[model samples]
Target: MPLKGSDSDDGGNDDLARLLSGKHAGKHRRRSRDADDDVNGFPRLRSPRPRDEEEPATPTSRRFQHRRRRGFVLCLRTPTAVVLSSAALWILFYALSLEGGDLVSIVARLGILGAYLFLSIALFVLAVLVAVFAKGIPRKTRGGLLAGLAGTCVALLIYDHDESLYHHGGYNALIFALVVMPSLAVGAAEIAIWKWLGARRAAMCHLFALFVAIFVVSARLSRAAAIWGRGFGGETMQPLARTCKPTKIGLPWVDLLPAGAQNFWAGGLTCAPAAKPFSAEIDADGALRVKCPSNDATYIPLPVTREWPQDWKLVEENYEGKLPQPFNKRVMDAIRRTEPFRIRGDNAPGMLVPRTAEAAIVTCDGVEKLVLRARRSNDTSSRTLRPPEQMTGSRQTKTLDVIVVFLDATSRRHFHRRLGRTVKKLEQANADGRTRLFQFFRYSISGFSTGPNSRAMFTGTSPNNLDTVSPVWEDFARARFVTAITADTCQDWGASYNPRPAFHFDHEMYAPFCHADFFAEDSNPLGNFRGPYAINARCLKGSRVSDLALQYAGSVSSAYPDRNTFVLAWLLEGHEGTGEVLADLDDGLVSLLGSLDWSKTALVIAADHGLHMGLNFAFTRNGAVEHRNPMLAFALPPWLADSEGRGETLKANAHKMVSGLDVYATLRGLGKVVDPTGFDDPDVRKRAQGGKNLMEEIVPPDRLCSDAGVPQWYCECY
Candidate 1:
């Protein structure tokens, strides 16, 4: 298209040619331009000539000129391009997540393991098929692109699977910048290099440019990895409490008590003289929990750190070659999938404990103290009450005291909101300066209400299953340990699936107290219910019901100081009204803990779920949070508490999603920990198929809701 000669009459085109001809070429440019050469399709220009003699350029020629700047054109007859591009994107996404790229997908939110398998298997197969069958693109070009795709896939497959990545579903543009456009660009460079990338110097320049592009990509990837590491922990990944958006009061780091709206006379369990009067105070346990603490009596707590008693022989578990059973599908769906939960008690008649603690007192009427044993003989228990035949020599083994303090309708957040003082006091309690109370922030619920949830938690099976052989309490009893349970209401008893829990216990405080029904008209504190144990009914005959249970349990524990005991006190005062009333009972809780024989006591202060009612509608959304996020705190002495032993594992697991099954599993293992030969029976020695001990075994980071026996509907962690 250039002219052969130049003249004054050549016009503007000639002038432009004249301007560029001399400086554009080297000394040999004139000689070399005599003939046309397709050197990597690089354009060539001749010395200036007359414009009248030059040939005009055509559209095709103009288009061909761009060939040097572009690479191979990947023409396709089918949607091969679309398929490969899509696969590439998927591979990129996975790679970023695995390699800590900009688009890291957290295991908790993405169910990363399952999704990773899908991408690795499905996408990889699809890509291979496209590579083999697709037509139109050059073989070399196809091979090169396929190589890149395969490399990306392999790289992703081998990338470390770290569950620490917190959920952050953003960074889509990174995929384009990393894979899509760069792909097109690399192809162009390849085509230019393979076809004659100009002279040696020009080829080197193009090579250098490609190297720079690669360096930039590597730098970007490094930055992405850094971002991934920064927000990995549950504590580091700040929770976005959408419920607090309008109120600006849900920040966790700041004081959360004010958020409870406790200033309302309606809030916080008040200890003021009752507006009305009744009797029955100053019981010994009551004295320990209330009077003694109020009067500042010289507190003498039981020694917690001591060698195992010489009289009680220690038993050891045997597990030379055993494996835990896997959870099956049927149990996973015991509840619906993908729905949220509610925290409450449904309509359940009562438990099947013999005539209640009332019978022990020689009258159908209730007594202030109905003393009884916690474990019932199997012969007296219903046929459903079968324990793994009292795990070989369990009776001879010495066990630790296991006390469970269950707070109905209490969420972890609500625990913080209502019992901030208790939380602080427990946090301060320690073994050699290490924290004593391990709080499980990621604890989740298995049901909306009390019935099914209790069954799941107590039995470690589907909540729907009516019959269970090893209720945790029963297991303790079978192992020659004393077990007892006291509750404010019978509706939410752990074994609610039965019209009356099929299996009966040795002692019965719930039935006796509830059936006693000693109440002042309209005194119920639990909302509209006017009888007994309502959200608003703070006291029964002037004694705080919450403190009463604690005192009773303490008294029972003291009754058999020589033997290990398992007592559960289900407190309900903190069960409703934003649950702020619990704040008033913090002192009682501290006193109870102070009196415990920490040396042998392993306490679990947990809740089935939270009660979302009470307070203003501002907390309506916050109520949803309370629904699934129940309170789960484990208070163990330095020795047994660190069964994760190092504290590292326990601390890590506290952040991962935990459920009732894990608690059940932990209970099952206590026998082995306390009395060596305790619960290591052949059937249970391998651990329950669906449960895991939170303190001992580490829960897999990639564990799914189903894996933990949490139905999809009730699953809130992911």
Candidate 2:
């Protein structure tokens, strides 16, 4: 059908092609303006040509013809305009690249970018002026106008992406968005002038513009891709020093490497004495408890009634995979009997949560695996729940949201291997100078296995029989924290490792269900992977238990946005195998790490130990090194890092020999916990007994494995 204003050319079924050539517009420009026909301030459009044959010369026919003319509308998009816009953009990008891509430089180049940004205001006023004063356009013509602009945008973006691959290092985001985009608008306006002359000439002009675009984009894209890809490559997190003790005899580069490999020095540090910022120790017989809040008030109400959260299925649904949007009845019906538990947790899992879920054991489909719904309903964190009234605010010098994740049997190298997605994203954020996570290059494990090592971090000592102590959580509780919660699939921790009364957390979640299911603590290592706790082949139901815990934590954050939360999660996915299976968690891990509210949050991600059970990984030389040295990383508040060179401080500390006990000290500092009795580690004028607070102090440069609390058998200080 012909467009209302261009009856001659719009009759063709090549509207998109016509739009590219700037036809189907202004065909009736020869006609005089008629104010009565105008809609709002826009001039009403009419066909430049009359009908081939007149309808009956009656008033009724004439009225019908006018209505038909008013209905047709079209976008006046043009390809020639796109070509001109491309030219102007190249100059802008070149200027931006020269100016260091900084804020001040950008403002200077944009002319109207200073404080008042008068240019932007003027543009806004100009648009308003056109909408208010311009005549001869119907209200629907505005949609057509937007379409014309949108068409130009689509063409530009397509050309740029295929040619530049901006993020793939073709052009930095700054130059691409700013210098190149607006040029298209300028080009589009230029072509509108040509269409005023006639459609035939404009269509002919599009051919020349097309040939030029093809030639220019082809000439530049290849060289730009090669240069930028090298300059702005993807980031890579190193698993270990490039040349470990036994592998130091070769060249650094492997020639062909993994995608996004840029950091040549991330693995530069050797097992040599390396560098130590500072270190000290205090004489102490046992680990010191976390300091309570300044007020030292307890917030636990008398009736501490407990129940599963209402939004458990929200997380359960995510675990089952991203549901299609719009959740139509058809979509809902398709997923009715499957995962996601749309109606209720128990309904979806087909199992009822036990009243005293702490001790109840259950199975999934007769196997020792749990349904995702079961995890949310039974195993998720509880003490972390804070009442709305308590969620008011904190009165501390600083209130940092703390997240502690204990990854079982994952080494620093293994972490880089399995959770590469999370690692790369955090690194990219770090590169952009945003809030991000960082890993310590020399975080040595203080204990042999998951339980003892983490216990040393949590309680400040890894004792065999002395399983009880003033747990670190008490300090958070006494501080009147809004919420403090821990979640684990098994009831007791350290059972597979230490073999004691199930090491109790403040609350046990999802343990009974795991027990009733096909829960086998490494004894039934069915597949190749093996350490212990490989329940139902490393899954609760069909989802990885790690993902369940991760999603649960995300849901908790979503469920309680206003409250301060302390989340402690134990991930057992890597414990039972070569841990290669952990690769599956890359996407989930990426989401969890990036989802945090980092402004006030403090994140700690550490592994208790590396590969231990698998003979292949455990017995190898590098494997042994990885086993002894676990990963410890922290994501502190962005402001703290920005002030006092603290980011640099963390980097320096990362290279120092540290262990879980030191982590205990750091936790005490972060919580701003004060021992109620005003006790300090004993200062004997000798070595410091307690672990060093990483923020306030550091482990001694020449610190030995024994000094840091690593037992002789597990020590690999070399």
Per-prediction TM-score to the true structure, in the order listed: 0.48, 0.45
Error of 1 at 242 (Å): 22
On TM-score, the leading prediction is: 1
**lDDT of all predictions:** 0.50, 0.46
lDDT of 1 by residue, 250-345 (tens): 222212235434324333344345442212222222221212112221211111101112111111111111213111111122212313211122
Model 1, CA-based lDDT:
0.50
- Residue-level error in angstroms, candidate 2, position 550: 1.0
Candidate 2 matches the true fold with a TM-score of: 0.45
Cα deviation at 254, candidate 1, in Å, is 13
Instruction: Give the candidate number with the greatest lDDT.
Output: 1
What would the per-residue lDDT of candidate 2 be over residues 66-105, giving only the tens digit for each residue?
A: 6546543312222222323433443344323332233323
Model 1 misplacement above 4 A: 1-268, 271-399, 431-435, 464-469, 490-495, 499-502, 515-537, 615-620, 642-646, 680-688
